[model samples]
Target: MDSGIICNNALITLIAIQNPVDRKAIERIKEMKNWQKKEFGQEIITLLRSL
Candidate 1:
């Protein structure tokens, strides 16, 4: 399986936990390089928005 897909699946699981989106989560996303952001940004944004 693609590593990006694997990572995204893990992210989905993490988001499933009841905790609120924290500064650390936002910072981690911000720390991602442009290419990484391109790979995962939209899914992250969509998931967080759904919360």
Candidate 2:
């Protein structure tokens, strides 16, 4: 599950379902963060984008 390749896809979905927000805005932020690093933090961003 943890191959050093952070999976932002799942985290984003969980958070989005829990808290709704503007899609476009969140996607922008997620992309920016993804460029920075795919660490655990980035996973959360990915989840948001998925939603």
Candidate 3:
């Protein structure tokens, strides 16, 4: 089930769990080296904030 977009498991897992973001998670996301991870993290945060 590829969406034809770069995948980020950390964000995927975070969203799958449907848990609120905490400072530790934010920091961990920031420390990720992959661009997809960072992008997904941002998207997740944005999505969460809009709710």
Candidate 4:
């Protein structure tokens, strides 16, 4: 799927985790522009895949 969808799913998973969610960070991510989200998501995906 596209980076945006992947990013959203990742965020959802993070929120579902037992650990405390960082509301401020989530809000910042949610406020990001579409292109920014796409780039950020793609980078994250790439980084994770490389690990």
Model 2 ranges off by over 4 Å: 1-7, 20-51
Looking at model 2, report the run of 10 residues with the lowest lDDT sum: 31-40
Model 3 agreement with the true structure over 10-37: per-residue lDDT tens digits? 6457554654464345556543446655
lDDT of 1 by residue, 3-33 (tens): 7644666555654553325444644653355
Model 4: colliding residue pairs: none
Error of 4 at 40 (Å): 0.2
Each candidate's root-mean-square deviation in Å?
Answer: 4.8, 7.4, 4.5, 11.0
Each candidate structure's count of clashing pairs: 0, 4, 0, 0
The TM-scores, one per candidate, come to 0.40, 0.25, 0.39, 0.30
Q: Which segments of candidate 3 are over 4 A away from where they belong?
A: 1-5, 8-14, 18-33
Which pairs clash in model 2? 8-43, 12-47, 12-48, 13-47
Best by TM-score: 1
Query: For model 4, what is the alpha-carbon lDDT of residue 36?
Result: 51
lDDT of 2 by residue, 1-51 (tens): 763334355654554555424444445444335543334344555655686
| CA lDDT, candidate 4, residue 34 | 63
What's the CA RMSD of model 4 in angstroms?
Answer: 11.0
The superposed Cα distance between candidate 1 and the true structure at residue 10, in angstroms, equals 15
